[model samples]
Target: MNTLYFAYPGELETPTGGYGYDRKIIAGLEDLGWQVELVPLGAGFPFPAAETLSQAQTVLEGLPAGAQLVVDGLAFGVMPEAASLACGRLDLVALVHHPLCRETGLSEDEASGLFESERNALGHARHVIVTSHATATQVADLFGVAEERITIVLPGTEKQDFAARGSSGKLKLLSVGTVVRRKGYDLLFAALDGLRECDWHLDIVGGLDADPGCHAALLQQLSGLGLTDRVTFKGAVAPQDLSGFYRQADVFVLASRYEGYGMAYTEALAHGLPVIGSGGGAVADTLPDGAAIYCGTEDTGKLRSALKLLMTNESKRLDMSAAARRAAEALPDWRDAAAQFAVALGGVRR
Candidate 1:
């Protein structure tokens, strides 16, 4: 079998959409008859300590010549210098969910360094794959890369039977992702606060992965909003349990400030639940025209209005639920994504 090197700084335990994306892609590649070896750079990760950096350098040096290497953008975005060294030695391709430059809450120096590094690293790649057109545009504008050089591969969602909407049951408001400030859980809490008069249960499904401090702060904020009773923080649900949560919910709400690609929304839609999401980045493009009420910002009034509109009107929710399923059906499976990716990589010499 032709070997493909899958390099990531974060280990298997990293709990985020990016980690999930890497695993899915690796699996898909293996199913498509490629020998995919997962090479982890250990815990220190993208912002590695001196030891982690040395270890990653050793891993890079040992890769066989002419082997196709796939790297996470996060692993390379911080250290452009390291990327240049990798590029000189390997046939590297980058799968960028979003640039680190676009990350929230970075010091000016840190952001500047990441921006430069990503640009350098992206330039060195044989192929630059992104999850959405929104990210492609951002990459072009920020890094001066032409749009044609970028490939858009939407993330795949697991298949599930869409549950029947029960009319007499308590409405479930669902949100899933890591507990991070960038995810805008704080805004979601504010939005849910406005819905206090309504009969609804909020299920915030996710755990802290990269940042524990932010997670604690978000929990405090949730408590301060007096939503502890109404909101259930089901920390780090396994893949098996995630399907059940989707099936149980009536409405799926994703209150992210922005996303490169919103996989949670796709999963909810697949389960036949009407989605309510913020209309930031690629959320509008990924979702069906009417599958969701896209709140353009974190405004409480708009979120409340959308919640009321989706929750109170049974027929509207039903229609949107159908639309959401249709959208999910239209999406290509991971197998298809892998086939397309293979075609792209086939152009490169063995």
Candidate 2:
């Protein structure tokens, strides 16, 4: 009864925040004495090819009868037919990081389709696990899920050694997330373009493989703004390598249009780095008041101002860095996150 199947898209070790959450939650559940088995659902999820979707359905159907299934929202939100078909044989629990319809790049038709499918899909789920209050609200209000069916288990932060910033005269800025349109890399580039007079360098640590079109467009914008030398796209790096980027950075920033829980922001705070961000959606609650300087995603002028305040004013940055550490001290670790998940699953079992 303690054994559960965790169905996710592609590899569990992937570097993106959603995959990373899946990995940590699995480990935490294991620590809680629950046996978790990973089921790969192939790749290109949420926009998978027809064959991929069919194969994913087959994978789910192949699981043992009445197996406890916790499916990642990336693929789960699209499977109304599969979910309905499996109703009597499988116990379905959806881990919805966010509603698929809310992704920024979708057209009206695409968004409406996702909304309908996810709403229909949720009707089959016994419970929904979300990472934030914002996402939980979205599930209940926008996705037509009930309040009693939702569980909010916030993303946990790892305790890390405080970043010992270097003596380099130039400010080192770090931005972490997949290089996608939703992350607002375009706005970040434009805002930094206005502060060309300052001695600053940006290191974007993220995977470029997720969205080729977005990555290509970002490259064009970077070149257009004459930032080829100012910003370095480190792509995705190993966790050990990423730690070095965090340790050397003076400030952390990402102009994300939205976030489910903003795991990157919390990771930044854990390293004691002051953050500059839009603090969109759940991110506003993810980061504490004194830990970050936030601006609206569309307000490049204000974003530039926040960037300037952190870059030119060392004292203010350091003050926020201290606050970031204090705030991070209060966030839950993996064990706590897993315990929350366990409670949600317990309800399903009952």
User: Clashing pairs in model 1?
Assistant: none
Give one digit per residue, the lDDT tens place, for model 1 in 210-280: 67988888778878888888888788877667888888788998788778888888888889999888846
Give the whole-model CA lDDT for all candidates, comma-separated: 0.79, 0.89
How far in Å is the alpha carbon of 72 misplaced in model 2?
0.3
After superposition on all C-alphas, the RMSD of every candidate to the true structure, in Å, is: 1.7, 1.3
1-350 per-residue lDDT for model 2 (tens digits): 49999999877888988988998999999988999998998888898899999999998899999788999999998888888877668889999998899898999999999999999999999889999999998899997788998999998899998765544799999999999899998999999999999999999999999889999998899999899899999999876677788888999999999999889999999999999888467977776899898786567888899999988888888889899999999999988999989988988873
What does the lDDT read for residue 37 in candidate 1? 83
Instruction: Estimate the lDDT of model 1.
Output: 0.79
Candidate with maximal TM-score: 2
Candidate 1 residue runs with Cα over 4 Å from true position: none
TM-score of each: 0.95, 0.97
